[model samples]
Target chain A: AQTVTQSQPEMSVQEAETVTLSCTYDTSESDYYLFWYKQPPSRQMILVIRQEAYKQQNATENRFSVNFQKAAKSFSLKISDSQLGDAAMYFCAYIGNSGYALNFGKGTSLLVTP
Target chain B: EAGVAQSPRYKIIEKRQSVAFWCNPISGHATLYWYQQILGQGPKLLIQFQNNGVVDDSQLPKDRFSAERLKGVDSTLKIQPAKLEDSAVYLCASSPLPVPVYEQYFGPGTRLTVT
Candidate 1:
């Protein structure tokens, strides 16, 4: 079984400040994918960013980027110029590239203070 | 272009009662999933299906929870003799067949409360 871990249970960041959420995984399979999902108060799981395990370059979407260290099995999410709307529960997930269901980490709640 | 749809946004029932939830995936999505999210925890996959055929159901509580996807499209999940522990948000998701690169689209979950 695969497991994803998010070290920070909760984090607070001032609006316009940058924040990074840490995530690590344990897996023997070399081929896998990583994702970060955001769930707001409405409880809808929304995709924030995704990273391919084979890609050396980090994946970025607008202000969202991933620091994916494949050798170390660490994938962290960085939110730049954080806004109050970014405040939500974030989860890191893993899936085998070949075929497998996603394994999710215990989420980290992010609070953006004005 | 539509997202996954789920019914019964909220449900409240007494312990040992029976309840059911429904889900409708995107038009062409062949893979559908059901997940459970407890308070302050990550979503856990309860069951996964590929075109009406179950691909995985390792974590689902077979004793009380049952699910079916008759036409490889819309699906339903049921829990009989509900327990207090069954109180959680049930999420439905769907993705295209095969590739892991395909993102799974989720629906606003159904909140089940067993009192």
Candidate 2:
């Protein structure tokens, strides 16, 4: 079974600053997908970013980017120019090419302050 | 486009009772998923459906939990004789069929409190 680990339980950042959340996973399959999901107080899980194991180039979206090091099984999310709205629970997830079910980490609570 | 929809944003029930949660996926989406999110933890996939047919339910406690997706659209999850430990948020997510780059969209979860 695949497992995702987010060592940090809580993280805080000031507005306009950059914060990085750490994530690592254990998987035998070489082809898989990694994702970062943000769940705000509304309880809606929104996709923040995604990284494909086959692609070495990291994925970036607006203020969100990921440092995906497949060789080390490390996939970290970096939030640039963090806004107050970025405060939420961030989850690291893994899904292999052969399955649709996502394996998730415990989560990291992010707090953004002005 | 409208994202996934889930009913009864909050529910409260005593132990030994039964409860059901409903979910409506995005239009034209071929995949639907149900997840259980315990407090302070990430959402855990309970079941996945591909057009009214189940694809995975390995982690689901079939002894007391059941779910079904009918007509390849709406889905329901039921917990019989709920346990105190069952208190958690039920999340619904949907996505198009597997492609090169497809993402799963989630709904506002239904928070269930079993007292």
Candidate 3:
């Protein structure tokens, strides 16, 4: 079994500032994947970013990036130049080689303030 | 392209009653998923389908929950004799089949309130 963990329950960042959300996971599989998903008040889960365990280079999507430490089983998301729209509940997820389903952490509620 | 679609954005029902939610995945998506998202928690996979076949349903509570994806396109999830703990958001997602690990596109979830 695999599990994802997000220790922080809530996070806040000023507009235009940066914020990082922490995530960790436990997996026995040598191959796997990690992801960050955002759910706003709209109740839609939007893909923020993704990373493959085989890739050594971290994955980044525009203002959203991840610091993936495979050895430490950590995959943290970094948001640069945060905007109010970035306010949402962020989730960290994992999937083994099958990639059939995702195991998600509780989530981190992020607030962006002006 | 159109995203995944789910109907009845919100639902309220008394405990022990039955309710069903509908979903239509993006055209051509071969894998469909049903997830449960409780307040203050991330979405948890309840079941998954590869085309019209059940691929994974290990976490689903079979006694009161049931789901099906017919014709490999649209899907439906149902809960019978709902419990208060069943009050949560039901999300539908879809992705292409096989390698490359395509990102799953999500639909606006249907929120269920079992009172």
lDDT (tens digit, per residue) of candidate 2 on B43-115:
8989988899988899899999999988999999999989999999999999897522688899999999999
In candidate 3, residue B98 scores what lDDT? Answer: 39
Q: Give one digit per residue, the lDDT tens place, for model 3 in B3-109.
A: 99999899999999999999999999998999999988888889999999998899999999999988889999999989999999999999987323888889999
For candidate 3, the docking band is medium
Could you give candidate 3's per-residue lDDT for residues A39-110 as a string of tens digits?
898867888999999999999999999999999999999999999999999999999996678889999999
- Model 2 ranges off by over 4 Å: B98-100
**For residues B1-115, could you state the per-residue lDDT of candidate 1 as single tens digits?**
8889999999999999999999999999999999999987899999999999999999999999999999999999999989999999999999997437788999999999999
**Clashing residue pairs, backbone N/CA/C < 3 A, model 2:** none
Better of 1 and 2 by lDDT: 1
True-structure lDDT of candidate 3:
0.93
Residue A27's C-alpha lDDT in candidate 1? 91
What is the C-alpha local distance difference test score of each model?
0.93, 0.92, 0.93
Ranking of all predicted structures according to lDDT, beginning with the best and ending with the worst: 1, 3, 2
Which parts of model 3 are misplaced by more than 4 Å?
Answer: B98-100
True contacts kept of each: 0.78, 0.72, 0.75
Clashes of 3: 0
> lDDT: which candidate is best?
1
